[model samples]
Each structure stands twice: as C-alpha cells, then as structure tokens.
Target: MKGRCDKKAHLTGYKAGDKLWVTDPTAAAGETLQWTKQPVPEYRADHPSSPPFLRYGHTATEYAGAAYIFGGRNEASVCNRLYRYDPYVDKWSRIAHGGMIPNARDGHAATRHGHCLYVHGGYDNDMEEFSRDLFRYDFREGVWHACALCDRWEGMHRDFHALSTVGDKLYLFGGKSDELEPYYSNRPVYDNHLYVYDPAAERWDRREAKGEAPGGRRSHSAFVIDGKLYTFGGLNCLAGEHYNTVHRYDPAANRWRLLRPHGRPPPVRRRAVACVHNGKAYIFGGTSPLIGSPMPAKSPAEEEDEPPLVDHSDLHVLEILHMAWAACGLPVPRHDGLETRPLLPRPTVGRRRPPARPKVRREVDHLRRSQSIFVRQRYGAQRPPLSDRHQ
Candidate 1:
C-alpha cells in the first residue's frame, strides 16, 4: 500500500469476460458503477470472423497508463500474444515482438515497475515444459528480454502459484509442479517454501516462511498493501480442499497471522484473482469444485459427470482499512468513498447461489454468514461467481 495514492483509485480486473473492468473504490456504497466495455482490435481487416482473445490464466498489469496483458490460453491451446489496452482510447492493440518471443503459456504471473513488465513461471505447451526463465517486456523499447537466472531451483518453473510484487522484489508463494489430471494416481504436490527475487539486487532467496504458515496451495491469489503481504483463498489438491481463510504477513516482522472477521464471508474458493484499490483488497473470479474432490460422487446420477466446475464472476471487496468482506456490484460514476450502508449485494449474471449450509453448533454460529450480503454483527458475503460446470 506504500506509494499508493490515498484517493481516486480503481482495481483493474479481467476474467471470464474477454474484456476489462475496474472497481472504483471512491464510488458511493452499493451504487452501480458506470463501466464501458472496450473494443478489441482486429488483427486483420479481412479476418472479421476471427474471435477476440479471451483468456484466464493470463496476467494483466498496469504500466505507464495502459494495461499490459500476456501469456494465457483459450479452449484449445496456450498463447503468447501480448496486448496493450489504453483506457484513454478504449482500445486493445497487440504488441508484436521484434525478436524471439517467450514460450506461450498460462497460469503464469506478471507485475510492472517503472516501464518494465516482468513475467515468470508458467506452463509452456510448445516445449511440453514449465518455464524457469524470467522475461521482461520493455514497453519503451518495444522488445522482449530475458533476465539472467541465478542458481535456479526446480520450484522456479511452477505455475498456478501466487506471485506478487512489492518494491523491487517479486515473491512466489506455495505452488505445485503438476496440475490435476483424471488418471494420475499420485495427487499434486505443493511447495511449502517461499521464493523471493530481488531483481534490483540480482538475487533469489528460497527460505522457509516462519511462524504458523498456511499449508501448501495453488491457484491462490495475493496482494501487497503498505509493505505487508495479504494472501487469500486457494486449493489444496492433495486433500481436495479449498480454503476461505485470509492470512497476513509482515515481512518486517517475518511472521504470519490469520484474519477472522465478523462480516459476511465469501464461500471457500480457489484460483480467483484480486487487486487492491484504495486501501481495500477486491477479489474476483476463480475456479472451485461444487463438492470436495478425490473420489467421484457416491450418487450414480451425479457420478455420470465430473464434479461441477465453479468459475465465479462476482466481485468482492475486503477492506484493507479493516479485514471485513462484502459483495460488490457494477461500478457507478465517481463519488466519495462508500459508506457502510446503502449497498445491495448481488452475484454476476446467471450465477446460482451456493447451496445452503448445514446448521452449525451455537459456539461458532457467527462464522457462516455470507460476506457479500450485509447482515448483522456476525455476517457472511457472497463467494466467487459461478461458471460453466461442463467446461
């Protein structure tokens, strides 16, 4: 959150939609925001039928007034196409690489500083490999450059992990070397270590995170505010479990703390993305299983198909000012900061609300409320927006 403007900011977001949207934290509470869907340019004038590039597992970062998106996949394969979206112009232009382009990949992470766009670790299909190389996309020069890796570890090649940037440092949290496949008897293994790369110092440090660290996970999301790192919701494939917890790490203190708040909480989910606007963390879409997975469902009717795939489109805001969670909707025109009341929570279009939960004991009754919905003292809110179960 250091070096961040204290006013008039928005969280840039992209997901199931092939376009972009942003959350203006300055808007009045619960008032729908006015967002425009931009036009994606045609690669060729004659190719009018060509589908626009829509992606997940891709990385988009704000740099020098434009949003730079790189490396992701569609239904059939991975992609290496780099794009720039200039909000001022409401247009998206593909930036062709002059020389060699890095391998096309998805599930990678990227961040920007100054004019440099840093991309690292994603699953590359062309080589049938996971990339260990760090690539820099220099907008000023319109060129692609690779960083010199030092004492590389196998972990550097992982995808689906949480990669975050703060200052000159790039930090990677828990990830697995493998993704889930139907017949792989061995479940995915997650890394418990933390890797920090100081591009300025030209250094990489792999060290065990101290204190009570969360278990290894993948497809999780993280963001930095005021120099402290905050991580949220992820999947533990080995156990087929998803986490709904929030953890905060203070590097200066080298410790972790779990945040349990009295507010509407989102449902357990994974692979969702997040951005920090104002001083709050806004989390968006990610995939989750309708039910815990490992073995198929016991019901023969349900066993005929795979577990329901949950891709959420709902918007959620976690006030960094406080740790409380609440559901958000489309943005409205600029206004003063949202007040505590005057908001109506709703998931994105066509999302079926999560099934009801079984009753809990009296002692922990306060924790089950939806975080997106504004309830009483003890609350809970909406979870990720639902997606196609078949895809």
Candidate 2:
C-alpha cells in the first residue's frame, strides 16, 4: 500500500513555539539593521474566512500570542464586533463575546494588562458624541465589563488618542478633541497633554513632562518599550498637518526626547498600527494626503474639492536598542565610526499654512545642538573636532 503525501506540508505557516526571524532585503549583505516587511498569510478574494475588512481607527492588542481586533469604521458604518487572529494556524475567527458589549465605535484606544484588555475613548456616530467611558474585557471569563471611575472625567473624553501599557500603568497621549474649546464645535482641537491611569488605584493622573513634547496630534501610534514610551506619526486635523516624527518619553525622569533615528523613515500618516518586539518597533498601514495636493478641507464646499488620500500598505521597522545605545553615547555597531545621520525635515503642505519651519523642526535642531555639546564634553579629547572630522 502506498502512503498519501502532501506537497505543501512544509509550508504550514509559522511554528507555534519557534522563534521568528525578520530579514531586511534593502540592507547590504550581512547588514540586518534596516526596515523590512514580513510575510503574512494571503487572503484570496474568494476565501470565505478572510481577515477583517479594510478599516481605519480600529484597536488591535496582542494577548496569549494572538492578536485581538476590535471596533473600527469603514466608508459605510462603524463596527463593534471582535475578531481574533491566530498566527500559528493563519486563521481569523470572529469572537462571539458575552455580556454588555460597548456600542459601535471608532478612533478608540485599547491596551492589554494582566488578563484583561482595557478600551477607552471613541466616537459613536449613532449618538453623535465622543465617549469617555472605559471598558474592560476579561480573557478568562470571556466577558466585557464597564469600569467605573471614582471621579467624573468630563475633559478626558476624546478620540484618536493613544493608550499604552507600561509597568502596571496605562499612559494616554495626545489626541483630537472637540469638547475643550469653541463650544460644541465641529472642528477638532489637538493637545499634547499626557495622562496616566493606574489600574491598582483606579484613578487617573495628569503628567507634566519636561523637555519639548511632540506636537499636538491625533491618530498616532504609541508603544511602551523597556519602561519608556514612544509615539509616532499622527495628524493635526485642525491644521491639516500630518507627522512622521518620533518622540520618546522617559517616565523615570518625566522627560520627552525627540528621536531623529538614522536612515529613511516612514512617510507622514495617521491611524497607523505599531508594535514592539525583540528590541524593534514595527509600523504598518496608514493614510496620508497625496503629494502636491490639498488636504481635506474643513468647509463643506472646500472639502468636496480636496483630493483623495493615499492609503499606505508598507511596513517599516526601527532599531530600538541601537537608538538607546546612541542615546547613551555608545557607538553604533557595524557602522564603523560614522555618526548617525539626521533625518531631513519634511516640507509642510496644504493651503492654510504659510511657508515656515514648523515647531518640530526647530526642536529637532535644538536637540542636535545639545547632543553635539554633550559629545564634546564626553569625547572631545579622544575624537577630532566636528568640523575636522566631517572634512
């Protein structure tokens, strides 16, 4: 008797307990310090059990080695359904969660802590109001619970913000809100204030950080790595400006440092998803205004004249440990003695703004000067002068 054989048995997706390796195709031979896209299971158009539909403003959190995706909106309507993606099996299953599910929302923020996932702040189109309510989903119980706060957080209601978990606490960062100013106005207001929520205490505290923070933004991505928090790529809807800048926040010192990582970075976008794994941060998928075209206008008449936005499908990665090493005055490995190159500032667009260097560019220049002074103090005797070395 002959045994049955399978030709595609070796391609069983990723192994359950095996380590994953990411390679950079653009890097020179033997150089792996660059951004590269990782392979994902393809979903055919005819496949019945495909991944979630294309949407923006959804929240994805990793739990139990699987990614849980919740509420987001498409062109037609918003969603409150929950879906889970299993990488090992390369499958997406819609989770039928129990208990009181929150209303359909988009622009919300979610983060995992312990066995529960915390979700907060989104806009509900049906109600036409932004949510300040916080909800928690217990993975063990498979239920959702509404978390009640001790104090009334009237001003904390917002959407397009970022929430990150760091050392038993959740940090909420900049987002666009209409509740603060202009009296129930349609225009969104952007802010850079940092707020911290302690699950143990069940309360929130506002953090006044030192150094220049990133500009007020919405729809940005935030990640907590090694006790520090980093934010990237958000938009200022009020000014019609998008950002590809990166900022690092040290909770121990309560300071913010704008990071100008060496090499090319991602384009200006918002509503991107970012995650940190094994000393690297991976960012994927966001939308940006078309180059040389006007942004979405505020007025109804002008809004119709704006061009369609460009949706990104690219992946970029940042070397977090190398950046930290550079911050600590250590030379980057495998690059000889070459210094990290500065990121060129992006040109401002849209019709509402005058031609001028934005505040972020000025701050980056200031940080560069400060870093130069620090290098002089620490390694002036061992190394040649900056001008001499460059020449």
Best by TM-score: 1
- Quote the positional error of residue 178 for candidate 2 in Å: 0.9
In model 1, the runs with Cα more than 4 Å from the true position are 1-19, 29-52, 150-152, 179-187, 291-306, 329-391
Model 2 is weakest, by summed lDDT over 10 consecutive residues, at 1-10
Alpha-carbon deviation at 248 in model 1, angstroms: 1.5
Write down the lDDT that model 2 would get.
0.60
Top candidate on lDDT is: 2
Candidate 1 lDDT score relative to the true structure: 0.58
lDDT of 1 by residue, 181-205 (tens): 1111122447767778887776788
Clashing residue pairs, backbone N/CA/C < 3 A, model 2: none
RMSD (CA, angstroms), candidate 2 = 17.9
Q: What is the C-alpha lDDT of each candidate?
A: 0.58, 0.60
TM-score of each candidate? Answer: 0.72, 0.67
